[model samples]
Target: MNWALTNYERLLDLVWQHTWISGSAIALGFALALPVGWAAYAMKSSPHGAVRQLSGVTVSLSSVLYTIPSLPLFVIMPTILGLGWLNPINVLIALVIYAFAIMVRGVVDALNAVPPSVLDSAAACGFSRGQRAISVTLPLAGPVMLAALRVVSVSTVSLLSIGALVGVSNLGSLFTNGFNRNFPTEILTGVVLTVALALVFDLLLVAAGRLLMPWNSVVSAGGSA
Candidate 1:
C-alpha cells in the first residue's frame, strides 16, 4: 500500500502506455473492418444468396476468435508470425481480429437499417450503385456506425490488459506485477484506472457521434414514441 502511493509515476506511465496500446489496436481494427463491412453490405444487396451467406460465414469465423483464450492467441501469434515474446504487434493483430466480427456485423446492420426507398430514390436520381452506397446509405447509417465504433473502442481498452501476459507492458503489467508481489493497492489502482479510461473513451465516442451524426438525435427523438 505504501509502495503504491510512492509509485505514482510508475502508475501514471502504465496508464498512458495502456491507453496507447488500446487506441492503436482499435484504430487497426477499424481500418481492417471498414472495407470488409462495406463489402458485406454490398453483398447483402446482391441477388445471389451465396454471396450474402459467404459474408455471414466470414463474420461468424471472426466471432469465434473472441471465444478463444487471449493468452493462447498471444502465445500462438509469435510462432505464427515469427515475432517472439514482448511484441506489441502480435497483441495488436489479435485485438484487431477479435474486433472484426462485431464491427462488420454492426456495419451491415446499420446499412440494412437505411431505408430502401432512399436508396431507390438515389438510383432514380441517376446515382450508380457505388454512389448510392457512398452517399445515401453511409450517410443514413452514420449514427449506427458510430455506435459500433464506440463499442469496439471500449472492448479493445479492456482487452489490452490481457496483452501483458505476453510481456506487452501496459496497465496490465501493473496488475501483473502488483499481484505477483502481493501489492493489493497497486492492483486496485490498475483496475480502477482501466475502468475510468474505458468510461472516458465511451463518453468521448458519444460526444463525437452526436457531433458527427446530428440526425441521430432527430431519429432518437422520433423513436421515443
Candidate 2:
C-alpha cells in the first residue's frame, strides 16, 4: 500500500499515455474502416460483380494486415519510413491497419442485419438508396455496429501494450520495464491497472452505445422472441 501510494504519479502517467496511444489508434482505425464498410454495404446492392470482388479484396487485404506480427510491423515501419524509435505516427498507422478488418466486417455485418422488410418498406415509401442507408439502414444496424466498436476498443487497448516494444512510453512500457528489472510488484501493478482501465473504457463505451442507439435495445428485446 505504501509503495503503491508512492508510485501513484507514475501509474497515473502510464494510464494517460496508454489512453492516448490506444485512443489515437482506434480513432484512425475507425476513420479507415467506416468508408470501407460503407463501400462494402453499397457493393452488396449493386449488380456489378466487380463491386463485390472489390469488397472481398478489401476485406481480405485488411485480414492480411491484421495477421502481420505486431512487433515486426513496428520494426519494419521505422526502417521503411525512416521514423526512428517510438514513432507514434507509425504506431498509430500499424494499429489502424491491424484493426481495419474487424471494423470493416463489423460495418458489413451491421448493414446486413437490417431486415429485408424494413428495406422494402423504405423503398415503397420513396426512400432513395442513399436516404435509406443514412436514415434507416445505419440506424437499424446501430447495435451491431456498437458491438463491433466495443470489440475493437478492447483490442486496441490490449494491443497498445505492444507499442512499448518499440519504446513507446505507454502502460506497456511500465510492464516491460518492471519485467526486465525482475520486479514483481511493478509487474503486478501494471497488469492490474491496465485491466482496470480496459474495463472502465469498455463500460463507458457500452453506456455510450445504449445512449446513442436506444433502438438497439428494442431490437435485442424482440430478437429473443
Candidate 3:
C-alpha cells in the first residue's frame, strides 16, 4: 500500500493506459464483428450448400485464430504489421483481434436467438431489412449481446497487462518490475488493481445494459430472485 501510494501517479498512468487499450479494442472488435456475425447468421440458413458451410468455416477460423498463444501473438505483431516491437499499436491490434474472435460467435448466437415471429411482425408492419435490423432485431437481441460484451470487457481488461511484457506500458509492467525487484507488494498491487479494473468495467457494462434494456433488468431480477 505504501508503495502504491508513493507511486500513485505512475499507477494512475498505467490504469489509464490499460483502460484506453482495452476500451479501444472492445469498440473496434464490436464494430468489425457486427457485420461478420450478421453475415454468418444470415448465411447459415441459406439454401445454398456452399454458403451455409461458410458460417461454420468462419466460426472455426475465429477459434483457430484465438488459440494462437497470446504472448507469441504480441511478439509477432510487429513482424506482421511492420511496426516497431514496442509500439503500442501492436498490442492494441492484438487485443482487438482477440475481442473480435470472442464476440463474433456471441453475436451469431444472439441474433439466432431472436424470434422468427417477432421478425415477421416487424416485416408485416412495413419495416425493411435494414430498418428491422436496426430497430427490431438489434433491440430484441440486446440482452444477449450485452452479456457477450460484458465478457469481452472483462477479458480485455485482464489481458491488457500482457502488453507490458512487450515493453508497451500498462498495468502489467507492475508485474514485471515487481518480479525483477523481488517486491511482493508491487506484484500484489498489480493483481489487486487488475482485478479491480476488470470488475469496474463489468459493473459499468451491467449498468449500461440495465439502462438500455430496462425490461431485461426486470426479467433478470425476477429470474434471479
Candidate 3: clashing pairs of residues: none
Models sorted by TM-score, best on top = 3, 2, 1
52 in model 3: Cα distance from truth in Å?
1.2
**Whose TM-score is higher: candidate 1's or candidate 3's?**
3
Summarize candidate 1's per-residue lDDT along 57-84 as a digit string, tens digits. Answer: 7677767767887789888988888887
Q: Which ranges in model 1 have alpha carbons more than 4 Å from their true place? A: 1-5, 219-225
Candidate 3: lDDT over CA atoms?
0.90
lDDT of 3 by residue, 1-225 (tens): 788999999999988998888889999998998889989999998999999999989978886777888889999999999999888999999999998998899899899899999999999999999999999999888889888888888888888898888999999999999999999999899999999999998898889888888877653434544
**How big is the positional error of residue 71 in model 1, measured in Å on the Cα after superposition?**
1.7
lDDT of 2 by residue, 112-211 (tens): 8889999999999999989987899878888888888888888888887888888888788877898899887887877787888788878988898889
Per-residue lDDT for 213 in model 2? 82
Clashes of each: 0, 0, 0
Alpha-carbon runs more than 4 Å astray in model 3: 219-225
TM-score, per-candidate, Cα-based = 0.89, 0.92, 0.94
Highest-lDDT candidate: 3
Q: Model 1: how far is 151 from its true place, Å?
A: 1.9
